[model samples]
Target: MLPSTSILFLCFLCCLSPIVPTSLNLTLPHQHPDPEAVVEKLQWKLNVSLSRRQMLGNDGKGTSSGSPSSFSCLTGNPIDDCWRCDPNWASNRQRLADCGIGFGHAAMGGKGGQIYIVTDSSDPDPANPKPGTLRFAVIQEQPLWIIFSGDMMIKLRYELIVNSYKTIDGRGANVHVTGGGCITLQYVSNVIIHNIHVHHCYPAGNTNIRSSPTHLGWRTKSDGDGISIFGARNIWIDHCSLSYCTDGLIDAIMGSTAITISNSHFSHHNEVMLLGHSDGYVLDEGMQVTIAFNRFGEKLVQRMPRCRRGYIHVVNNDFTYWEMYAIGGSANPTINSQGNRYIAPADVYAKEVTKRVDTDEKDWTNWNWRTEGDILVNGAFFVPSGEGLGVLYAKASSVEPKSAGLIQQLTLNAGVFGDPRDSVSVGFSGGTTTSGSSTSNNGGGDYFGMIFGGSAAPPPPSLTITTALLSLLVIIILNSRHPLLYYIHPLLKHST
Candidate 1:
């Protein structure tokens, strides 16, 4: 019998040795990364930090506790409140005060000793005084009109001209000004148009080209623009949605500055936002403008605001399915575009491999498309423009064939010629020109010269001929050393 210790040691050695396969092996398919995890990681890096207390609000002092009488009173000298001692104001004040202890005095001071009338749907007397119809009375110190209602709709027959300091408190209402040619604002300053929906006001038959431009032009007759701010300053257009218009959604034409357009949605129009028109008063340069956190939707084409030499800060906006270029700036306007998600058309990635070759017969010397760090993938070269050309599409094989041809054509078109007189003949083939040419070829001898002229020597023919051959080689290499090659052969034999 073998030694007992030796026998145990031999058994241990056998267990530790690698197992030799008696049959074929198998492998699994490639697994893609999780998209949700990618989105979550991106959000984690970009989410703005906010205090928990700020979101919930101060203990109890911030919100109304029920009694209108207990409502916090407003206090500002030369206040613009429309709620005061008017008979209409008293009735509206009492109705709200009866609700509870917190519903009385307006948080923003009420206007003193002026009657501002608001037509109520449930009032017995249409013209006479009614509770809540008075809403808030404005002190007539500075020519003001105030209207208040919750979800109220009002129709106007004539144009409403607001000349002085006017505040129309809709109390969050859908204010419809219909059959009126237009609402004109003349020499108005410090106008606050907040939380109101103004719509469906079309231009009249009068071709008053001075008052309205839509009547004169043949293509300008649709629902008309939502709001027109002419000769106004310190304007705020917030939390508003403008749509279904014939012209632009928001027209801030001529001499309107110090504008802040935040938290708004613009869609369904020819021109979404028009800053200054050619005919209007020339807006001065360096006007401060901020466009933040707005969603611009689909089917909108040519959405550019023409501002002359203004400072524009466009940040944190989502643009989807845009038909043409999203934003264009003229007059050397200072524009900063950051953190915007641009989704390309869907059909650009349907094919596995496509080859495109640019045979520039007309200008063989000008192969503009060939640039440094450009990669040719599966017989297709993907060249990007600007600094970010390769960062996003860095992979060697994923660029489309058509993109390569487009970049090459651009390169060739920008080349220089040997003869100064003949601009088309870029870069000399070691020849002297009639104009006493310098030996350095300073103008045409650089990279720019190569872009315009054909290569000094013809590139190896194998460079073009081997593209398809290389692709086949890659396929054969992958198949020969495949993880499950052993199993695949056996499986095929078994099936046969």
Candidate 2:
């Protein structure tokens, strides 16, 4: 095996290599929907997600189980509080689709599709992918709730072009797409990628790759992003762990919008996330993204989403560590930061969380960048620009803001792991039982009987009466014949 330094050097060389595409395949898909309508719908979803909490009040830490080491079933956050803690999550996986919040709430990825199990881990061919492989599962036309038969590491020879209406669900098993080309969602819609690990991706392309059953196109070199969203909308990436890629860990550029990245962990990289393609690219002005309930942890540098022209809502995330700066942008993006815990580094000069890249103060001072209800520590401070602004910043305020004090509870389970005992620690404190006791996983959700290292298979949550009620509310709204916003507004109408 090569050293980590040697591996990084090779990845760098691969990224710099020039590989051009010779064939143009026009049948895949492309979309540039109007951001005005998309943001209005997103704004509505955020309001509905908030409506339930008002109905339930400010309680999150539910009555504890009698066990000495037990986690409260409800975590006080709207998304997770929607019965993800129900021990039956493994059997009723489709229910997870209705719990989305923020901009990507409407992305119902493969909710009604067949459950396709990936039994093979090898990607022997990029163009003619075999059945039972993950590559084949994602490129299919029909909606699919894709799952892994067991723990597998799928390395690709080229970027995995995810088709629309697909959900890559990695709940009961450990799924990894690493050590080569990673995922690319270009001009697609309604896609969800959850609970997977994507890392150590080097540039892989410059060859023929298949996107669907009959279409294969020449692909140029990729940026090796863990997940690259290009001209795609209505996408959600949740509870995934991303790190150490050749380029940005997650880059949504070239007119992507209506996206939410929540409950995920990011670390050990430079230029962590890029929200826009370029300053001169006018199409990216339509981008709207929500970064919520995520944990940005150790060994990470700047660009925890460096923005361009767009509307970005940064809500209730835990920034326990960062060098240089945490949030950055250029091209007069409207940034609304609310209820995040920002702990700056020891360096005095790097305390500010916001960076208006390359632009002079005269131009950036007029930008609508404001931090509300944020908790800054260790000499950390946020420079609020264009305060008292209502219209543009309100577009970014689609998501409701929780108190930063609740960040520890909101983001405790940011990343994915099969067993709690084996989960990687982000070095931030949270209330959890490492004993792995009191959490039961019985019946057919055995997870191949291998995930828990021969112990009990620990799911995300255990059940409670409150969580059951919460789940019922979500089910009612999702199943209602009327539009979602109409149902939620009346429910929250009587409340303040």
Candidate 3:
């Protein structure tokens, strides 16, 4: 055995390790928030938002078609209309905390924290990040409202590991996270990612990375997912553009729940979004996600959220193209799809929007999958299965869904709407190709090119995967006999 001093030092560092779940912002596992109560709260918020929307479409029929009155900046998408239209949004960014309206509505990210401005756009040192860099901002122990100083593209050399109670707000700048491992929220909670572009993310790992100011641990190879949520809760991703990744654009698994993915754009990829891991991950049974007010656009193949055992709400979105099925699942998940537009491709065999992977008809017959007021065009269809789940949906779908006719208007500003200078596209997969009509039938360019272009600043990439997956897991094994190096910090230089 080592000396007493050496043993104490090892224990201290172990507590500071990112993998240890030592965060203070969340309650202990024994004192975990009640899942049923969380669902009830989400139901209340959605019902409240629905009650406020005078969803009198032009024809006064919500079941058929119509839209909100023309005299307002609001688009009937409760989340976007809450803050995107405000002229003073940049000044009162924190007010956005009150605008959340779904399972993640309780995620008050960085609301009580001080604002942290990221003025540096440099590639970060995974072990010793410099102050003012985006890496430094996210690794802090305290809550922080992080925003960019100007328009810039950040290509991270490592996977970005975000801490709890933080908000990465990219409202006014042309921010992009590309070229390396993208955002990873692991064993943390209460994070808000808004108004940025996340695409062309590649896998990165096999290095020592920092989490808190005092912790630096070895990392593993990451899946190139744009936003990877692993064992986290209370996450909100809104108003971002995502495309062209080696893996799923946004993947949440390993018991990650209470998530809201809204007002975003996804395109030019194979597997689009994944909500659960392999079908055998029983821990994911508690996962609950809200996919709302987004546009699943051109060149997407499948997995507009391939789910597993969990409760999923797919509401108020637009599905334009999918080479394969749009939504798929296994291991008995409750899917509540309401008030969305699905435009199937010309492929006759792919017209059906749902697929239950490997599960037989008899077994999946009782899984609660239903669609309410969804507009299926171009012969597209959703074959829903299952039996009575009124109680589950009552809390999930209390929000009277908006009309599908208003999808274009609601998702028109889905991505980074800006000028030519405000965006960038780089991917190993085929990208920059428009899958559907570029022009809108409504005279305004809101379709493929229909997606209005705009400029805002961006963040960078970071590594991701289970337990950090294949990479970080190896580190954990090695750390038993040989701990990570903390003394490497003095050699790394940074701003005062």
What clash count does candidate 3 reach?
Answer: 26
lDDT per residue (tens digit) for residues 1-21 in model 1: 334654475555446434522
User: Which stretches in model 1 have alpha-carbon errors above 4 Å?
Assistant: 1-117, 120-145, 154-160, 177-183, 205-223, 279-282, 304-306, 338-496
TM-score of 2: 0.71
lDDT of 2 by residue, 160-185 (tens): 98999999999888998985569988
Best by TM-score: 3
Task: Report every candidate's CA lDDT.
Answer: 0.33, 0.69, 0.69
Measured over all alpha carbons after superposition, the RMSD of each candidate to the real structure, in angstroms, is: 32.9, 19.1, 12.3
**Candidate 2, poorest ten consecutive residues by summed lDDT:** 447-456
Provide the TM-score for each candidate, comma-separated. Answer: 0.41, 0.71, 0.72
Off by over 4 Å in 2: 1-71, 387-404, 417-496
